[model samples]
Target: MDVLQIVAIGLMATVLIGVLKSQRPELAVLLSVAVGVILFLLVLGKIGSIVDIITDLATRAGISMVYLGTIMKIIGIAYIAEFGAQICRDAGEGAVATKIEFAAKILIMVLAVPIVVAVLQSLLKLLG
Candidate 1:
Protein backbone atom coordinates (compact mmCIF):
# COMPACT_ATOMS: atom_id res chain seq x y z
CA MET A 1 0.00 0.00 0.00
CA ASP A 2 1.17 3.50 -0.81
CA VAL A 3 0.80 5.18 2.55
CA LEU A 4 1.96 8.51 1.21
CA GLN A 5 -0.59 8.55 -1.57
CA ILE A 6 -3.36 7.59 0.81
CA VAL A 7 -2.29 10.18 3.35
CA ALA A 8 -2.10 12.89 0.72
CA ILE A 9 -5.60 12.11 -0.51
CA GLY A 10 -6.93 11.91 3.01
CA LEU A 11 -5.44 15.27 3.92
CA MET A 12 -6.76 16.86 0.78
CA ALA A 13 -10.23 15.47 1.38
CA THR A 14 -10.22 16.56 5.00
CA VAL A 15 -9.17 20.08 4.17
CA LEU A 16 -11.73 20.36 1.42
CA ILE A 17 -14.44 18.97 3.67
CA GLY A 18 -13.57 21.45 6.38
CA VAL A 19 -13.61 24.29 3.90
CA LEU A 20 -16.93 23.16 2.53
CA LYS A 21 -18.46 22.95 5.99
CA SER A 22 -17.23 26.36 7.14
CA GLN A 23 -17.28 28.50 3.99
CA ARG A 24 -18.05 28.03 0.30
CA PRO A 25 -20.19 25.01 1.03
CA GLU A 26 -21.11 24.47 -2.58
CA LEU A 27 -17.53 24.47 -3.76
CA ALA A 28 -16.56 22.22 -0.87
CA VAL A 29 -19.18 19.68 -1.92
CA LEU A 30 -17.89 19.77 -5.45
CA LEU A 31 -14.34 19.40 -4.24
CA SER A 32 -15.17 16.35 -2.18
CA VAL A 33 -16.94 14.67 -5.08
CA ALA A 34 -14.16 15.56 -7.46
CA VAL A 35 -11.63 14.05 -5.08
CA GLY A 36 -13.64 10.86 -4.84
CA VAL A 37 -13.84 10.55 -8.59
CA ILE A 38 -10.13 11.21 -8.98
CA LEU A 39 -9.31 8.50 -6.46
CA PHE A 40 -11.62 6.06 -8.21
CA LEU A 41 -9.96 6.70 -11.54
CA LEU A 42 -6.56 6.08 -10.02
CA VAL A 43 -7.71 2.76 -8.56
CA LEU A 44 -9.32 1.83 -11.86
CA GLY A 45 -5.95 1.97 -13.54
CA LYS A 46 -4.66 -0.58 -11.04
CA ILE A 47 -7.68 -2.76 -11.68
CA GLY A 48 -6.94 -2.65 -15.38
CA SER A 49 -3.43 -3.83 -14.71
CA ILE A 50 -4.81 -6.73 -12.68
CA VAL A 51 -7.18 -7.65 -15.49
CA ASP A 52 -4.34 -7.65 -17.95
CA ILE A 53 -2.34 -9.97 -15.72
CA ILE A 54 -5.29 -12.32 -15.33
CA THR A 55 -5.78 -12.47 -19.08
CA ASP A 56 -2.13 -13.29 -19.60
CA LEU A 57 -2.25 -16.09 -17.02
CA ALA A 58 -5.44 -17.52 -18.47
CA THR A 59 -3.94 -17.58 -21.95
CA ARG A 60 -0.88 -19.40 -20.67
CA ALA A 61 -3.07 -21.96 -18.93
CA GLY A 62 -5.18 -22.52 -22.06
CA ILE A 63 -8.30 -21.30 -20.29
CA SER A 64 -10.94 -19.59 -22.37
CA MET A 65 -10.54 -15.84 -22.70
CA VAL A 66 -14.31 -15.48 -22.54
CA TYR A 67 -14.34 -16.86 -19.01
CA LEU A 68 -11.55 -14.56 -17.98
CA GLY A 69 -13.41 -11.67 -19.51
CA THR A 70 -16.56 -12.55 -17.61
CA ILE A 71 -14.67 -12.64 -14.32
CA MET A 72 -13.12 -9.28 -15.04
CA LYS A 73 -16.53 -7.88 -15.90
CA ILE A 74 -17.84 -9.09 -12.56
CA ILE A 75 -14.95 -7.45 -10.74
CA GLY A 76 -15.58 -4.21 -12.62
CA ILE A 77 -19.27 -4.30 -11.79
CA ALA A 78 -18.45 -4.76 -8.13
CA TYR A 79 -15.95 -1.92 -8.06
CA ILE A 80 -18.32 0.43 -9.87
CA ALA A 81 -21.20 -0.47 -7.61
CA GLU A 82 -19.14 0.11 -4.50
CA PHE A 83 -17.76 3.35 -5.84
CA GLY A 84 -21.21 4.69 -6.69
CA ALA A 85 -22.72 3.55 -3.42
CA GLN A 86 -19.96 5.15 -1.39
CA ILE A 87 -20.32 8.39 -3.29
CA CYS A 88 -24.05 8.39 -2.79
CA ARG A 89 -23.68 7.71 0.90
CA ASP A 90 -21.12 10.43 1.19
CA ALA A 91 -23.61 12.74 -0.48
CA GLY A 92 -26.23 11.75 2.09
CA GLU A 93 -28.35 9.55 -0.12
CA GLY A 94 -28.26 6.23 1.67
CA ALA A 95 -31.54 5.03 0.18
CA VAL A 96 -30.44 5.77 -3.34
CA ALA A 97 -27.15 4.09 -2.65
CA THR A 98 -28.86 0.92 -1.49
CA LYS A 99 -30.98 0.89 -4.61
CA ILE A 100 -27.89 1.32 -6.70
CA GLU A 101 -26.31 -1.66 -4.95
CA PHE A 102 -29.40 -3.77 -5.54
CA ALA A 103 -29.44 -2.87 -9.20
CA ALA A 104 -25.79 -3.74 -9.56
CA LYS A 105 -26.30 -7.13 -7.95
CA ILE A 106 -29.15 -7.92 -10.31
CA LEU A 107 -27.09 -6.89 -13.30
CA ILE A 108 -24.20 -9.04 -12.15
CA MET A 109 -26.43 -12.07 -11.73
CA VAL A 110 -27.90 -11.59 -15.17
CA LEU A 111 -24.50 -11.29 -16.77
CA ALA A 112 -23.24 -14.41 -14.97
CA VAL A 113 -26.05 -16.63 -16.19
CA PRO A 114 -24.45 -17.51 -19.49
CA ILE A 115 -21.11 -18.20 -17.88
CA VAL A 116 -22.80 -20.44 -15.34
CA VAL A 117 -24.57 -22.40 -18.05
CA ALA A 118 -21.35 -22.85 -19.97
CA VAL A 119 -19.56 -24.11 -16.88
CA LEU A 120 -22.32 -26.58 -16.12
CA GLN A 121 -22.22 -27.92 -19.62
CA SER A 122 -18.47 -28.27 -19.53
CA LEU A 123 -18.71 -30.17 -16.25
CA LEU A 124 -21.35 -32.56 -17.60
CA LYS A 125 -19.27 -33.27 -20.67
CA LEU A 126 -16.28 -34.09 -18.53
CA LEU A 127 -18.32 -36.46 -16.36
CA GLY A 128 -19.78 -38.25 -19.38
Candidate 2:
Protein backbone atom coordinates (compact mmCIF):
# COMPACT_ATOMS: atom_id res chain seq x y z
CA MET A 1 0.00 0.00 0.00
CA ASP A 2 1.01 3.61 -0.52
CA VAL A 3 1.88 6.23 2.08
CA LEU A 4 -1.46 7.98 1.56
CA GLN A 5 -3.34 4.79 2.34
CA ILE A 6 -1.29 4.22 5.47
CA VAL A 7 -1.86 7.80 6.58
CA ALA A 8 -5.59 7.44 6.02
CA ILE A 9 -5.68 4.28 8.10
CA GLY A 10 -3.74 5.98 10.91
CA LEU A 11 -6.00 9.02 10.86
CA MET A 12 -9.13 6.90 10.99
CA ALA A 13 -7.73 4.83 13.82
CA THR A 14 -6.77 7.92 15.78
CA VAL A 15 -10.28 9.32 15.45
CA LEU A 16 -11.87 6.07 16.50
CA ILE A 17 -9.46 5.67 19.41
CA GLY A 18 -10.18 9.16 20.72
CA VAL A 19 -13.88 8.59 20.57
CA LEU A 20 -13.65 5.20 22.27
CA LYS A 21 -11.26 6.25 25.03
CA SER A 22 -13.99 7.81 27.16
CA GLN A 23 -16.68 5.20 26.66
CA ARG A 24 -14.63 2.05 26.02
CA PRO A 25 -11.02 2.31 27.05
CA GLU A 26 -10.31 -1.36 26.41
CA LEU A 27 -11.67 -1.12 22.91
CA ALA A 28 -9.47 1.88 22.26
CA VAL A 29 -6.39 -0.18 23.13
CA LEU A 30 -7.56 -2.99 20.85
CA LEU A 31 -8.13 -0.57 18.00
CA SER A 32 -4.61 0.76 18.40
CA VAL A 33 -3.14 -2.74 18.30
CA ALA A 34 -5.19 -3.68 15.25
CA VAL A 35 -4.12 -0.58 13.36
CA GLY A 36 -0.46 -1.24 14.17
CA VAL A 37 -0.71 -4.83 12.96
CA ILE A 38 -2.41 -3.83 9.74
CA LEU A 39 0.21 -1.23 9.00
CA PHE A 40 3.02 -3.70 9.63
CA LEU A 41 1.43 -6.26 7.33
CA LEU A 42 1.12 -3.67 4.58
CA VAL A 43 4.83 -2.93 4.73
CA LEU A 44 6.01 -6.55 4.82
CA GLY A 45 6.39 -6.68 1.06
CA LYS A 46 8.67 -3.67 1.04
CA ILE A 47 10.79 -5.16 3.81
CA GLY A 48 11.24 -8.34 1.77
CA SER A 49 12.45 -6.42 -1.26
CA ILE A 50 14.90 -4.42 0.85
CA VAL A 51 16.28 -7.61 2.32
CA ASP A 52 16.80 -9.01 -1.19
CA ILE A 53 18.72 -5.90 -2.25
CA ILE A 54 20.93 -6.05 0.86
CA THR A 55 21.69 -9.70 0.29
CA ASP A 56 22.58 -9.03 -3.36
CA LEU A 57 24.89 -6.18 -2.40
CA ALA A 58 26.58 -8.27 0.26
CA THR A 59 27.21 -11.03 -2.29
CA ARG A 60 28.72 -8.57 -4.77
CA ALA A 61 31.04 -7.23 -2.09
CA GLY A 62 32.21 -10.75 -1.23
CA ILE A 63 31.19 -10.27 2.38
CA SER A 64 30.61 -13.31 4.52
CA MET A 65 26.94 -14.30 4.62
CA VAL A 66 27.40 -14.91 8.34
CA TYR A 67 28.10 -11.22 8.96
CA LEU A 68 25.23 -10.10 6.74
CA GLY A 69 22.87 -12.50 8.51
CA THR A 70 23.95 -11.23 11.92
CA ILE A 71 23.35 -7.65 10.82
CA MET A 72 19.88 -8.54 9.57
CA LYS A 73 19.10 -10.25 12.84
CA ILE A 74 20.19 -7.18 14.78
CA ILE A 75 17.96 -4.96 12.65
CA GLY A 76 15.05 -7.34 13.07
CA ILE A 77 15.51 -7.34 16.84
CA ALA A 78 15.51 -3.55 16.94
CA TYR A 79 12.31 -3.21 14.90
CA ILE A 80 10.47 -5.93 16.77
CA ALA A 81 11.48 -4.48 20.11
CA GLU A 82 10.34 -1.00 19.12
CA PHE A 83 7.03 -2.35 17.87
CA GLY A 84 6.42 -4.20 21.13
CA ALA A 85 7.40 -1.20 23.20
CA GLN A 86 5.02 1.06 21.27
CA ILE A 87 2.17 -1.37 21.77
CA CYS A 88 2.90 -1.54 25.47
CA ARG A 89 2.98 2.24 25.69
CA ASP A 90 -0.31 2.51 23.84
CA ALA A 91 -1.85 0.21 26.42
CA GLY A 92 -0.49 2.37 29.24
CA GLU A 93 2.18 -0.09 30.31
CA GLY A 94 5.34 1.94 30.30
CA ALA A 95 7.14 -0.46 32.65
CA VAL A 96 6.58 -3.36 30.33
CA ALA A 97 7.79 -1.33 27.41
CA THR A 98 11.00 -0.51 29.22
CA LYS A 99 11.58 -4.15 30.01
CA ILE A 100 11.08 -5.09 26.41
CA GLU A 101 13.68 -2.57 25.33
CA PHE A 102 16.18 -3.87 27.88
CA ALA A 103 15.71 -7.44 26.69
CA ALA A 104 16.16 -6.44 23.06
CA LYS A 105 19.47 -4.80 23.88
CA ILE A 106 20.76 -7.91 25.55
CA LEU A 107 19.72 -10.04 22.61
CA ILE A 108 21.43 -7.68 20.21
CA MET A 109 24.64 -7.87 22.21
CA VAL A 110 24.52 -11.65 22.11
CA LEU A 111 24.11 -11.60 18.35
CA ALA A 112 27.11 -9.31 17.96
CA VAL A 113 29.48 -11.66 19.74
CA PRO A 114 30.45 -13.51 16.60
CA ILE A 115 31.24 -10.35 14.68
CA VAL A 116 33.31 -9.04 17.57
CA VAL A 117 35.25 -12.29 17.78
CA ALA A 118 36.08 -12.16 14.09
CA VAL A 119 37.39 -8.63 14.41
CA LEU A 120 39.47 -9.49 17.44
CA GLN A 121 40.92 -12.49 15.67
CA SER A 122 41.93 -10.36 12.70
CA LEU A 123 43.61 -7.85 15.01
CA LEU A 124 45.51 -10.61 16.84
CA LYS A 125 46.72 -12.05 13.55
CA LEU A 126 48.03 -8.65 12.45
CA LEU A 127 49.90 -8.22 15.76
CA GLY A 128 51.52 -11.65 15.44
Candidate 3:
Protein backbone atom coordinates (compact mmCIF):
# COMPACT_ATOMS: atom_id res chain seq x y z
CA MET A 1 0.00 0.00 0.00
CA ASP A 2 2.10 2.86 1.27
CA VAL A 3 5.52 1.77 0.12
CA LEU A 4 6.96 5.19 0.77
CA GLN A 5 5.88 5.12 4.39
CA ILE A 6 7.49 1.72 4.86
CA VAL A 7 10.67 2.87 3.17
CA ALA A 8 10.71 5.99 5.28
CA ILE A 9 10.34 3.93 8.41
CA GLY A 10 13.18 1.68 7.30
CA LEU A 11 15.40 4.64 6.64
CA MET A 12 14.47 6.14 9.99
CA ALA A 13 15.35 2.88 11.71
CA THR A 14 18.69 2.76 9.92
CA VAL A 15 19.41 6.28 11.02
CA LEU A 16 18.42 5.48 14.55
CA ILE A 17 20.83 2.55 14.52
CA GLY A 18 23.63 4.79 13.42
CA VAL A 19 22.85 7.37 16.07
CA LEU A 20 22.36 4.84 18.81
CA LYS A 21 25.60 3.08 18.01
CA SER A 22 27.62 6.17 18.85
CA GLN A 23 25.72 7.30 21.97
CA ARG A 24 24.37 4.19 23.73
CA PRO A 25 25.12 1.01 21.83
CA GLU A 26 23.31 -1.22 24.29
CA LEU A 27 20.16 0.85 24.15
CA ALA A 28 20.54 1.13 20.40
CA VAL A 29 19.88 -2.59 19.97
CA LEU A 30 16.77 -2.36 22.08
CA LEU A 31 15.62 0.73 20.23
CA SER A 32 16.13 -0.97 16.88
CA VAL A 33 14.15 -3.98 18.09
CA ALA A 34 11.42 -1.71 19.37
CA VAL A 35 11.21 0.09 16.07
CA GLY A 36 10.92 -3.21 14.22
CA VAL A 37 8.25 -4.36 16.62
CA ILE A 38 6.27 -1.15 16.12
CA LEU A 39 6.40 -1.61 12.38
CA PHE A 40 5.33 -5.22 12.77
CA LEU A 41 2.36 -4.13 14.86
CA LEU A 42 1.27 -1.71 12.18
CA VAL A 43 1.37 -4.46 9.56
CA LEU A 44 -0.46 -6.88 11.84
CA GLY A 45 -3.22 -4.32 12.36
CA LYS A 46 -3.86 -4.31 8.62
CA ILE A 47 -3.91 -8.09 8.57
CA GLY A 48 -6.43 -8.11 11.40
CA SER A 49 -8.77 -5.90 9.40
CA ILE A 50 -8.52 -8.33 6.49
CA VAL A 51 -9.35 -11.27 8.76
CA ASP A 52 -12.35 -9.38 10.14
CA ILE A 53 -13.60 -8.87 6.59
CA ILE A 54 -13.20 -12.56 5.86
CA THR A 55 -15.11 -13.48 9.01
CA ASP A 56 -17.90 -11.10 8.07
CA LEU A 57 -18.15 -12.56 4.59
CA ALA A 58 -18.19 -16.08 5.99
CA THR A 59 -21.01 -15.11 8.30
CA ARG A 60 -23.03 -13.64 5.46
CA ALA A 61 -22.48 -16.81 3.40
CA GLY A 62 -24.08 -18.90 6.15
CA ILE A 63 -20.92 -20.79 6.90
CA SER A 64 -20.55 -22.46 10.28
CA MET A 65 -19.26 -19.98 12.81
CA VAL A 66 -17.25 -22.75 14.44
CA TYR A 67 -15.35 -23.32 11.22
CA LEU A 68 -14.81 -19.60 10.66
CA GLY A 69 -13.60 -19.24 14.20
CA THR A 70 -11.31 -22.21 13.76
CA ILE A 71 -9.80 -20.65 10.65
CA MET A 72 -9.22 -17.39 12.51
CA LYS A 73 -7.66 -19.30 15.37
CA ILE A 74 -5.34 -21.01 12.95
CA ILE A 75 -4.34 -17.64 11.56
CA GLY A 76 -3.70 -16.41 15.08
CA ILE A 77 -1.55 -19.44 15.79
CA ALA A 78 0.50 -18.91 12.67
CA TYR A 79 1.06 -15.24 13.44
CA ILE A 80 1.93 -15.85 17.08
CA ALA A 81 4.23 -18.73 16.20
CA GLU A 82 6.03 -16.65 13.63
CA PHE A 83 6.34 -13.81 16.12
CA GLY A 84 7.66 -16.04 18.89
CA ALA A 85 9.99 -17.89 16.55
CA GLN A 86 11.36 -14.63 15.18
CA ILE A 87 12.01 -13.31 18.66
CA CYS A 88 13.66 -16.58 19.66
CA ARG A 89 15.85 -16.52 16.59
CA ASP A 90 16.73 -12.90 17.25
CA ALA A 91 17.78 -13.92 20.73
CA GLY A 92 19.91 -16.71 19.28
CA GLU A 93 17.67 -19.53 20.38
CA GLY A 94 17.13 -21.62 17.28
CA ALA A 95 16.04 -24.61 19.34
CA VAL A 96 13.33 -22.59 21.02
CA ALA A 97 12.15 -21.31 17.66
CA THR A 98 11.84 -24.84 16.38
CA LYS A 99 9.81 -25.82 19.43
CA ILE A 100 7.46 -22.91 18.91
CA GLU A 101 6.89 -23.90 15.29
CA PHE A 102 6.31 -27.54 16.26
CA ALA A 103 3.80 -26.57 18.91
CA ALA A 104 1.95 -24.29 16.51
CA LYS A 105 1.63 -26.99 13.87
CA ILE A 106 0.41 -29.56 16.40
CA LEU A 107 -2.16 -27.17 17.82
CA ILE A 108 -3.38 -26.26 14.34
CA MET A 109 -3.87 -29.94 13.53
CA VAL A 110 -5.74 -30.48 16.76
CA LEU A 111 -8.03 -27.54 16.04
CA ALA A 112 -8.68 -28.83 12.52
CA VAL A 113 -9.93 -32.22 13.64
CA PRO A 114 -13.53 -31.05 14.02
CA ILE A 115 -13.62 -29.66 10.50
CA VAL A 116 -12.16 -32.87 9.20
CA VAL A 117 -14.83 -34.87 11.03
CA ALA A 118 -17.57 -32.69 9.60
CA VAL A 119 -16.26 -33.24 6.10
CA LEU A 120 -16.11 -36.99 6.60
CA GLN A 121 -19.67 -37.02 7.84
CA SER A 122 -20.85 -35.12 4.78
CA LEU A 123 -19.00 -37.55 2.53
CA LEU A 124 -20.55 -40.56 4.25
CA LYS A 125 -24.01 -39.08 3.90
CA LEU A 126 -23.44 -38.52 0.19
CA LEU A 127 -22.27 -42.10 -0.21
CA GLY A 128 -25.34 -43.43 1.59
Per lDDT, the best of the predicted structures is: 2
lDDT-best of 1 and 2: 2
All candidates in order of TM-score, best leading: 2, 1, 3
Worst 10-residue lDDT window for candidate 2 reads: 83-92
Estimate TM-scores for all models.
0.79, 0.93, 0.72
lDDT of 3 by residue, 36-92 (tens): 787877687688789889888998999988899998899889988998787667556
- Model 1, stretches more than 4 Å misplaced? 1-3, 22-29, 43-48
lDDT of each: 0.82, 0.95, 0.85
Alpha-carbon RMSD of each model: 2.7, 1.3, 3.4
TM-score quality measure for candidate 1: 0.79
* Model 3 spans with C-alpha error above 4 angstroms: 1-3, 14-33, 43-48
Which pairs clash (backbone N, Cα, C closer than 3 Å) in model 1?
Answer: none
| Winner on TM-score (1 vs 2) | 2
Choose the strongest candidate by TM-score.
2
Q: Give the lDDT of residue 67 in candidate 1.
A: 78
